[model samples]
Target: MVWAIRGATTVSNNDADEILTETQNLLKEMAQKNGLAEDDIISIIFTVTKDLDAAFPAIAARNIGWTSTALMCMNEIDVPGSLKKCIRIMMHVNSDKDKKDIKHVYLNGAKVLRPDLT
Candidate 1:
């Protein structure tokens, strides 16, 4: 079976190190919580708010040795009241777990994006 896991986190500022670190942390948490292995990952799509342009969140995946995994990054739509400096990820992976058992991660300021999950 295949499933999609969602996660999001915010950087303190538009700094490359901060973006990379926070994104890496979020990705690690998502994988850890879901018991995901790199071989099972299909693809990962990362979206950052317009305010976060210091670096591409995909680099964080690469830094963690996800060299062969499909990864992409883009900017989120500039909605008037949306969160700023936020990075969101949608990861598709092969999993045997039931949908309801999947764990979605929300960290930092992005926790507000999903009150129930946080």
Candidate 2:
């Protein structure tokens, strides 16, 4: 079976360290919650709000030893009144777990983006 786990987090600032650290933290939490290993991950797509330009979230994955997993980074659509300084992720993985059992994570300011999930 295949599953797509969703997650989002926000950085307090646009600093490179802040962005990278927050992204790594979010990814680790998602993996831990879902019982995921790097091998189980097929790919990850990350999107950042227009205001965040300090770093690429994919680099966080690589820093965490996700060298073999396919990764891409993009800009989130700029919508009026949308969340800012947010990094959203969609991780595709090979999993045997039921869809309903999968966990989605939202942290920091991004928690407001998905109240039901957080």
Candidate 3:
């Protein structure tokens, strides 16, 4: 079966290093929580808030040896008064676990985006 794991995190700043670091942390947590391996991942789609443009979140996955996994980056639709410096990911993976067993992670200021899941 295929599952789409959701995760999000916020960077303290708009700097490239901050974005990469936070994204890596979010990915690591998601993978650990879901028992995911690079081979199990089908793809990952990342979206960043309008305020973030220093780097692409997908680079964090590549830096962690997920080079074979398909990845894409996009901008989230700007909403007035929304959280800033946020990076969200939807990772598709092949898993035997039921959907209800999947864990969705939200960290930093992005936690507000999915308080129920967090």
Candidate 4:
């Protein structure tokens, strides 16, 4: 079965290092919590708020050695009162795990995105 997992995180800057580090952490946390291998990931879509455009979030995935795993990064709509400096990711994976068993990671100030899961 294919499972879709979602995670959100916030970064204070548009620097490559900050973007890469925070994104890497979020992805690692999600994979670890769900016991996902690189092969398990079908695709990943990353989005950053308009306030951030220093780097592509997908570069973080490659920095973490997610070779052959599909990745795309784009800008998120800048809605009023919405979270800023945030990068969100939706990862589709092939897994036998149940929805209830999946762990969706919302880190940093982005925890507010999914307070129920946090």
- Top lDDT model: 2
lDDT for model 2, please. Answer: 0.95
For model 2 the local lDDT of residue 9 reads 97
List candidate 1 segments past 4 Å from native.
none
Which pairs of residues collide in model 4?
none
Backbone clashes, each candidate:
0, 0, 0, 0
Give the per-residue lDDT of model 2 (tens digit) for 1-118: 9999999999889999999999999999999999999999999999999999989999999999899999999999999999889999999999999999999999999999889997
Cα shift from native, residue 78, model 1 (Å): 0.8
- Spell out the clash pairs found in candidate 2: none
Against the correct fold, how does model 3 do in TM-score?
0.97
- Displacement of residue 89 (Cα, Å) in model 4 is 0.3
Candidate 4: count the clashes: 0
lDDT of 4 by residue, 24-80 (tens): 999999999999999999999999999888889899889889999999988898889
Runs of candidate 4 exceeding 4 Å displacement? none
Q: Please list the C-alpha lDDT of all candidates, in the order they appear.
A: 0.95, 0.95, 0.94, 0.93
Cα-lDDT of candidate 3: 0.94
- Quote the positional error of residue 9 for candidate 2 in Å: 0.3
TM-score of 2: 0.98
State every prediction's TM-score relative to the real structure: 0.98, 0.98, 0.97, 0.97
